[model samples]
Target: MDFGPFLLLASLEGLVQAAVLSLTALGLCLTFGVMRVVNVSHGEFYMLGAVIAWWAASILGPKYALSGYLIALFLAPCIVGLLALASERFVLRSLNYEPEATIVATIGILYIIQQTVLMSFGPDAKPVNPPFYFRIDFPWFGYSGYKLFVIGAAIVVLSGTWYVLARTRVGLIMRATQLDRDMAQAFGIPIKRVYAYVFAAGAMYAALAAVLIVPIRQAHYLMGADPLLMSFIVVIIGGLGSVRGAIVAAVLIGMSDGIISMFFSPTLAKMVSTLLVALVLVFRPQGLFGVKTS
Candidate 1:
């Protein structure tokens, strides 16, 4: 392929990556920003989503591709959300959400989930059949229609999330809680309930991202590490609790990954991203969009 065509294709791939990363990192940011909790197991939830999606594919069969995908699209997030809710209730809540302790607790959860999946699902990567497939033939090249759908879906989900956080009463309460937990509680916001739901919401975001990406990347036991690391990088570069920032950072990182990987290698792309993060940390520790506190 010519350089122009290659670059165009790379950019499209990067946009897709950004879309998925936005959802995953946004979830991480929400948990950290609102609940002040670090969920080391967040990536596990993503892995679980992909695994469940593969199960959905298995049950429904290739003949029912679209149906299977739709079922997994809705079902996986719900299941992951429930698991997140339960973990928040039983583990984080009992530990009082102390930063250091919750970190340790979630790490334990990560290992448990990883090992369980390893034992049950085995170590092989499972490919998922996309719900439907069509190719958009450009003059220079072709692209997957499903990937474009993913980009649109990401836009819709991000917009809805923004509306809820910025416009709705539910959002108002959550923001109030995020801004001032003691005051919100004094005003009758159920702090425990909010944290539980928020945690679940975060996990659901990760799961949703996984569902969207599973067909492309397939399901694997150890796939969570990259998403988890990139999410933390996104959160750091974008500014904690800044939805807009997270989206922007995801695009920046995702696009860079795509373009660099096209010309050189994926590993080099990651190294460049990490270097960007290091520079950001040194120059703006609060993140590109985060607020500085006294």
Candidate 2:
């Protein structure tokens, strides 16, 4: 109603978006960071999560909405992760993980996944019921409880990822492999196995994000395109292969969409973000948090 309440509502919406975008972009960034392979099919993994969640919900029935969501929560990521692992072993590994070849193969994978979902599910947007429904009454507006849950869930996941990367032996191995694959192999690290796991983890992250957002946005065969483009924008603006950068950029871009779209239009919001990316490219090609490489 009022500007203050309107702004607050927009910010709240933006937080939900930021939370999901961080997970989506993080997956893409991590794939590039550790494996040095650009997985263009990353968004398709996200779509699969939503699609699978819809399937699980239909089977479980509306009487068991909560149970359906819970099943999808775990099932989507596991299936997506395994699929990613298979793709890595059979497709990427066969390509020798060459950057160019991997890109083309992943593009093909993207189209294949999109068309398959379109054929099987048809060209319709499928909605999944939220696990719980409640409203939080603010001074001037109401907020969805599930949206808050999305934000909290994302934070927990991000923190766990940070802990894994910063404090665990697995993280050490990953960092070592990322730093120098030949050297990591020389020290007896199974680089091939590590790559497989990293790729799977990346897909799992995308799937997790999709499961969270599906209730709010609904699932469609072509839905992956926007997230894929947004992830690329985030990756570019944040600097390629930078985890922290991707998260930070996702927040900035996600929030901007909310505020700007509220005051203006979604198209204008996108234009602003694109302009910001251009400015960043011109002034700081390495990005705000990215380290320069020789």
Candidate 3:
């Protein structure tokens, strides 16, 4: 077996995975950092995004002679955000300041979403093909143009998020809220509205990541499981609410998964990744960039 080409493909796949993981982790960080809720059901939200995108592309894109793919890309995240708003307003709002209860509620939400999708679309996988197939070949590597596009789009979204959170007034309020909800409320910040916005924004990011991943993994009801695990490991290693930590951990995890899968079995690769996450948590429970929690 030729090692050169194999390594190149693995590198490309790793880059793509890293980008997806980072975007998803960013969403987790935003929610965890701001709401202090351990949302274990975020993976289901990602799956919803992918499935919604696939259905929209199939139903609306072709019949009206429109760009089904583009429509999916735009609409799926919005739908996810709307769902997040509904969930936060109704369920999560009731569980405010109750982290354990919020976590349990999110888990319930996850199963509900999974079963709902299964009932609506059945358990079969759905394919979302790109509009065009073009590869930009280079001396070092060659990969699907669509995959490259996914990476590019993820980068753009992550960068835009960073800009918003770091530069804008809303972002300042978000950060202020994350630092201390009670304090922010005392200082005239609309704490409830901030929570809603953060939840919606994080949901939007998760949905967007799922939409981008469809071309790579296809769509299925249970597709959220693995990514959800990966995202949790990332958030844990990076630290809650630390976007930089998430990115760094995502790259490490992505590269580890990619290189290991190339040489070993998928099952072994996952086992090793889980072990690594455990070790990280044992030593640094707060995560690499996480603030110390009382």
Candidate 4:
């Protein structure tokens, strides 16, 4: 195959990665942007989604694998989201949403989730069958149809998220809360409830990303680590609270990662990503899309 075709394939692969990363980072950004709480355990929620999907698929796969996988696709995130909502009400709310304290609390949550999954799911990596299988033929190669599905699904979910945030009253309430929690509360915005919803929504996004990618990558208890790191890098480079920035940055980073991994090595790709993040931090502390806060 010519280098041009190779590059094209690499870019497609990158798009898939970027799509998943964008959703994951958006969740992180929403939590921080709106609630000012850095969820250290965010990746665990991603892992939890995959684990739950694996469980759901396993139970249902025996009878109707496709239907089971489809059910898991929707059910896993809801389970993870509800768990997150409960955690926020019980753990974070009790802490009064203090940033530093929430960090510690989420760390505890991270360990708790990881260990629980380890005990229940065991340490082995588990794979889920894709709902359907096909390939897109190219001049020199073919790409995964399922991966394309992931990218398309991400676009749809992201669009729905945008509509919710931009066109709906809930979005208005969340935005108002993000801007000034005290004032929003004074205006009867139910800041505490908003915080709970945002936190759960953030977790739901991460879980959705996990469900989308679990078919490509097997579910493992430790799988959350890299996604967490990549998500943090994306959020930081894109601007901590900017959804547009997160999506843009995810594309840039994901493409670079795919191309670099194809041509060089994944380690090198990660190194380059880390270097890019450092450069962005040094030059643009507020991030590409983040606004300066006083």
Best by lDDT: 1
Report, for every candidate in turn, its global Cα lDDT versus the true structure.
0.92, 0.92, 0.85, 0.90
- Compared with the true structure, what per-residue lDDT tens digits does model 4 show for residues 1-294? 788998998899889998999899999989988998999999999999899878888887756767877888789889998999999999999999888899999999999999999998999999988877898887689888999999999999889989998999999998999889899999999888899989999999999899899889999999999888899899998888887888888888888888789999899889878887888888988997778777
Query: Clashing residue pairs, candidate 2?
Result: none
TM-score of each: 0.97, 0.96, 0.94, 0.96
Per residue, candidate 2 scores C-alpha lDDT tens digits across 1-294 of: 988888889998888999999999999988888999999999999999999999999999999999999999999999999999999999999999999999999999999999999999999998999999989999897789999999999999999998998899998999999888999999999999999999999999999999999999999998888888788789878888888889999998888777788788888788777787878878888887788888
lDDT of 3 by residue, 156-273 (tens): 9878888988999988998898888889999999998888888888888888888888877889999988888999999999986777788888888887788778788989999877
Candidate 1 vs 2: which has more lDDT? 1
CA error at residue 254 for candidate 1, angstroms:
0.9
> What's the C-alpha lDDT at position 245 in model 2?
87
Give all candidate RMSDs, comma-separated.
1.1, 1.3, 1.9, 1.3
- Residue 154 deviation, candidate 3, in Å? 0.9
Worst 10 residues of 3 by lDDT: 60-69
Higher-ranked by TM-score: 2 or 3: 2
Off by over 4 Å in 3: 61-66, 139-142, 291-294
* Candidate number with the higher lDDT (2 or 3): 2
**Backbone clashes under 3 angstroms, per model:** 0, 0, 0, 0
**Model 3 clashes, total count:** 0
TM-score quality measure for candidate 1: 0.97
